[model samples]
Target: MVDEVKETTVHELIASPFVGAYLVLRPGSPRGLKIPRDKYLQLGRKAADDVCPAWLVEATRRCWNLDISGRGVNDAVVVRTESPYGYGRASYGLNLGCNYDREHCYSTSA
Candidate 1:
């Protein structure tokens, strides 16, 4: 039998501990060479299953499916979620590789 999917709101998904943990694992910016297609698929599936946000899952799926090279997993997520306020908020607090420099850190203003 097919399992019924439970509906979850953006707020609820963001509030979920699972989503929080998943976001912590995701990169907020590009940091390395592109992830291999096979690896991206594997990681994406794992992330989709672990997170409560439907949008994040979908974004992971679509980003991994792209043919572009040199894009890291976190870069994919950042590119996909940077727009549209809701998705952006869902991905907030991500480690964007600029946390050390006060002038460049997103949390700080120039």
Candidate 2:
């Protein structure tokens, strides 16, 4: 008999309502994020205070880099250009005042 194993991904984890909402409510969001709500909360240990959000974003950006060679760090992740849009700005609490009307502001999805 052979034992079967299963692999889990960040997207699968962030699909739950709890995890989804937490990520959405986070400061810097990705492009098309899809994960379990409970799992997302577990990874961030509280969506309000995610430490290495950029690191996660960077991983996704790497995929894009494989296609576009000259994109450079600028094309790494949406967070790199999401400050102006209010997607990468979590320090403003949860009031939803972001306009997202500039190249600087962008969103990256996992």
| lDDT scores in order | 0.34, 0.34
Best by TM-score: 2
Superposed Cα deviation of residue 6, candidate 2 (Å): 48
Write down the lDDT that model 2 would get. Answer: 0.34
Per-residue lDDT tens digits of candidate 2, residues 1-110?
99988863222112123211333222234333443444344443533333434434454455322232233321222221123333432323233465664333354534
Candidate 2 at residue 53, lDDT? Answer: 46
Residue 55's lDDT in candidate 1: 41
Residue-wise C-alpha lDDT for candidate 1, range 85-110, written one tens digit per residue: 22334322354333453432344544
The TM-score of candidate 2 is 0.21
Model 2 residue 64 CA deviation (Å) reads: 8.2
- Model 1 clashing residue pairs (backbone): none
Off by over 4 Å in 1: 1-51, 66-102, 105-110
Measured by TM-score, how close is model 1 to the native structure?
0.19
